[model samples]
Target: MILDVILDALLDTAKLIPFLFLTYLVMEYLEHKTKNKSKQIMQKSGHFGPLIGGVAGAFPQCGFSAAAASLYSGGVISAGTLLAIFLSTSDEMLPIFISESVAAGTILRILGLKVVLGAVSGSAIDVLWRFGGKKRREREEHNHIHREHHEKDIHDLCESEHCHCENGSIIKSAFLHTLQITVFIFLISLVIGFCVELVGSDKIGYFISTKPVVGVFLAALVGLIPNCASSVVITQLYLTGILGAGQMMAGLLVGAGVGILVLCRTNKGVKENLGLIGILYGTGVFWGILIEMLGIVL
Candidate 1:
């Protein structure tokens, strides 16, 4: 059993390498091509970041969310954009639906709902962020100042991701970045997988009992397992007539693949990370309750 779990983790972690490498490669190219005023215009145009992220994230690939987290950590995208991708990402849901032979219309509805919600929610968060506290643009100013005179001791997420960004070859740097994050993800996934196995799947079901109100809340918690298993279980339960559409949506909304795990590992500030998680969980719970109240069938 342990060996099987280990192998599963290894294979799963391996899947992320190509995506990570590709994401880093794109970022490296942009880094080389864009600069100063060009960068500022890009950031300014990020008013639509959530929309872009939403569409991109709605695809079947889980790597998009991971890539978004890395981008947010590096200040390449706004937190709202990160939230949008994380919110829309369905992880294993797409494949499960296709394999289960679910109707194409039904699948599109689900995907469309996630995309719309993710885009709206992400934009809202960005608006709130701009008004509630310091704007991301203002913070970028600090990014330019030399380390010697900085007040905040925050480490650059780009540098923390890897020091290879300055290397001559973009491919080499991207590969190294991919390798580093892959190793980190493998170790983390291994530990998480072992713990999940130790706890047993039966316990997960028990926690999200059949009660509608209770299940809606607990399902979101279950959605946060940081592995593909959470999504598989949630989607299966929904199709089996165990979970309601609202409850399923709730779980799926929180099911951002390993995006949260990557965020926690890479992003600076414990409070900031926790805050993001809180927002994510709250979004899931809020929608779950609202959907249940409205009797909106998907």
Candidate 2:
């Protein structure tokens, strides 16, 4: 069993590494080329900001989440856009699923649903906030100023040489990041596979598939963990048939890589971060239940 698990993980890793490396390389190159233009593009996206953010966030990397947080802090992007990025961010799941040989149709369906959910939820939040009266806006404005000053302080503390990465080669950075993620994924996959073997697929499925409401709640909470580890766990479970489509959706939707952590670190106060967490959790659970009701099976 141990040997089988190890071999399976190695095979999956082999399938993913090339794609992962190439994707990151392209992303890094694009980011380096468009760093300045991105801010202007995001600013001008306006009402379509959430859609644009959601699409960009679909890339299987946490870097976009951090970038989105920075843009939000700098007031270059709206709260809606930031949330959209958070909602749509899948961390390493996309690459893992593709590597696992999951059906392309299913992958597309899941991706489409996530992007739609992100756009709709983000737009709704923005609309609701608009009519939420002046007091909240005033407080938010105060927080924004504080966030800027706090960011400035952090920037001042860092040496100028360390602050800029313009001279760094995107290919080198992409290769490093890809290698890091691949190692992490392989380790997690081996552990998860071994555990699944011990626990039995039916037993695990019974836990999550029997009571979807509780499953979704638990899965969403797990997804809130601020690392790619959560994504690995969720994806492994789903691929093993331990989690149903609804449960998988709930967990993956809420698993926004390090987006929440970035929000907490960059935002002015705890209240805002807490609220965003609540929003993400609530949205994930709601959609999970809705999908369950629709009887969408993976």
Best by lDDT: 1
Segments in model 2 whose C-alpha atoms lie over 4 Å from true places: 1-44, 133-210
User: Could you give candidate 1's per-residue lDDT for residues 118-226 as a string of tens digits?
Assistant: 9999999999976766555456567873333221111264466656457567787778777878888888888888988888767786677578988999999999888
Candidate 2 pairs with clashing backbones: none
**Among all windows of ten consecutive residues in candidate 2, which has the lowest summed lDDT?**
152-161
Residue 270 local lDDT, model 2: 71
What TM-score does structure 1 among the candidates reach?
Answer: 0.89
Backbone clash numbers for all candidates listed: 0, 0
